[model samples]
Target: MRSVYMQSLAYVDANRIYSRIMELGEIGRTKQSGVQRLALSKEDKEAQILVTKWMEEAGLTVSHDHFGNLIGRKEGEKPHLPIVMIGSHIDSVRNGGKFDGIIGVLGGIEIAQFIYSNNISHAHTLEVIAFCEEEGSQFNDGLFGSRGMVGKATEEDFQKKNDQQVTRFDALKNFGSEIDPARYKESVRKEEEIKIYLEMHIEQGPYLDVNSHPVGIVNGIAGLSWYTIMIEGTPGHAGTVPMNLRNDPMIGAAKVIQEINEICSSQPDQQTVGTVGIIQAFPGGSNIIPNAVQFSLDLRDINLTRKNRIFAEIEERLQAICQENGLSYTIKTNIELDPVACSEEIIDVFTSIGKKLDMDIPIMVSGAGHDAMLMSEITDIGMIFVRCKKGISHQPEESATKEDIAMGTEIMLQAVLQYI
Candidate 1:
């Protein structure tokens, strides 16, 4: 099939798009004028209801998967063809900004809404989704919905617990999801079922904001490796155990954690980054020595070779640190993936449209993680980024102009229509 060429965009209701974004924000409005709609929370349910209403009004047939991802379908002239999928998550962090994931969903809906209202003829069906728990703030695991959709979610994902001591299993049940937690494989969409995937999101960094570009094309998302390192040592009384004689896991953990920073920073301009997001020491007492220490390391980089070498160096140093401190250790690789490149075909469409629109579209490699990365496992993926103020995101101050978002939507609309 060939793309349907359009000399101009049929229409994109910028006002309606902005209004919907603000409307969704009102559901979990925080004192800081942000959103706290964690996945499966009450606020998330409220937002889902409102979004569902909007989807129906936009002429979509909406339904919920067993995982609770809100999916909306718009049938095309040819319904059996692999679908063109677009959208992002609606669930936000504890106090996230209004536009992070909201733009992609609303933008995709606007495209679908336009196609339906204008009665535009297309050969492939269009699908929009507001994936559940992309923020993962509730269950301490992000990308739950996207991963589930792609069959990448692991057994450890659904078993994770929240701060309230509630397992994800119970939380999904409370939220009206038909998930068994043990076996929710029905939600996975086969690679052949999707033609391509697209998403629009805030830059979440200052590149575009600093360059004063309203919209940017994402070249790719960085690869990431997550490791849970455990250090074990003999427990003893802090007062009685001399520092020279004690086998201390905390000492080993501290040394390894510090090395993680130094190793990733070795190549400063390479964009290699490593962070220890979590740390825990057992026998939490001022007078007691920790018997074990557990910590999480998140390493990411656009260059896979650099990322791997850095991780290897960290592990090498970790072994030395453990041996020096008389501690035994284990490393659990929770997740590891190579960088995902955007679909060059879809990317060319965006760039052409941007040039036609007289917009300067910057191509950037994402340093942060995104659901688009997982979609890469199944289908061609493309991402458009709208500039947020100062590149701030995941907080109350995260801001993206309605005009920028509309501009990105217009580009997406034109580009997606080409595929039809």
Candidate 2:
């Protein structure tokens, strides 16, 4: 293999990679320019088809797993060697930006194209992947595909329903990627030789954009906990129920969410943040007092001890509110994700690659979750970040410059060259 020009790699048909990103983003574009390709949605399946076609055109063997993850393998000099994987989720949140997860997977594809043209061959296999269902937009099941890969998903998970329109099993079946019952008990990492897992994504925050950096190396990811709360109360006519007499769950819920924010806010420098994303009452009409209210709370922090402390404070606050309001409440933690630290070895390699290419790069932590977090539990993981215009994500305004994408791809190309 010839030596990479490093900086010149950014100019190698850079427009082509950007064009491909735009093309793929258009497949699931909603009315607001936000992407709508929720996991296993028809849009997601279509995007898979399109990328698979491109992978085949790139002369890579492509296939889908039981979890619907699209894997495109570019065989290296040694077919049996451990694989070097680079990718991110293909599914997007509702009204999400085009470049968030797409950049990573598409960037991997672009890297494969660059390697092919350069005739670079490694002793190990290289795979460009598009992980399915990372967002949990369609069904509140985050990192479904990666969870399956790590053998975390159970048989009961298949029975979970999404708004009565889709079941996990049904969605997989629709995509022709259904998992057998027996496979549920099988291991995801059949081979213990995975060298490293790499992901390239937009910073999804203002750090890189504000700092004027084109590329970033991720050091860690924040811990996350999602919980659902339900408060039950007696129903009554709005006008007839006195404020003190009424067991209004809505009032209690409002107080709880407010207190949750206040508690987490008391932490140092806002290390903890909580959001009650969804809230609704049983008697949603204006004429009646709400008998019950259901809501969800998402809490996140970089430290696990602080995360737990915040959660405890939230629970205590909610219990007090319900007690004072004379209402019954139930809480269930839907998911708990521990903070993940990237491998120092992988981080050094990425940093060295950036310096070798004279790219301005800095170390950072991800505020959002990615499949990389899960992959870290199984093997050494590394991440590259391209800057978004305003550090905005999960919205239509999210934007990344072509130069940033090209630079990230160049860094990844160098890393892959050394890693594989």
- Every model: Cα RMSD to truth: 2.6, 2.0
lDDT of 1 by residue, 1-420 (tens): 333566876378999999999999998999999999999888998998888888888889998776778899988788889999997989999888899899999898898888777777888988999998887688766788888889988777777898998878778777765445555787889999999999999889999988989999999999988888999998999889888999999989989888988787779695998989789999678788999999998899999998888888888999998888889999998778799899998888899998899877999988888889999999999999999999899899988887888999999888788876
The runs of at least 3 residues in candidate 2 whose Cα sits more than 4 Å from the true structure, single-residue gaps closed, are 1-12, 177-187
Candidate 2 residue lDDT tens string, 1-420: 665334444534568778988998898898998888888888888888888887876667897777777889988787777889998977888878888788888888877887777776567888888887898887786887777787777776677778766788777876764444345445376436577899999998899889899989999999988898999988999888788798989889989988987898888776677888889889698888888999998888889998998788788888888889899999987778999999999899888877777765899888788898888777889999999988888898989998888888888887887776
How displaced is residue 158 in candidate 2, in Å? 1.5
Weakest 10 consecutive residues, lDDT, candidate 2? 3-12
Backbone clash total for model 2 is 1
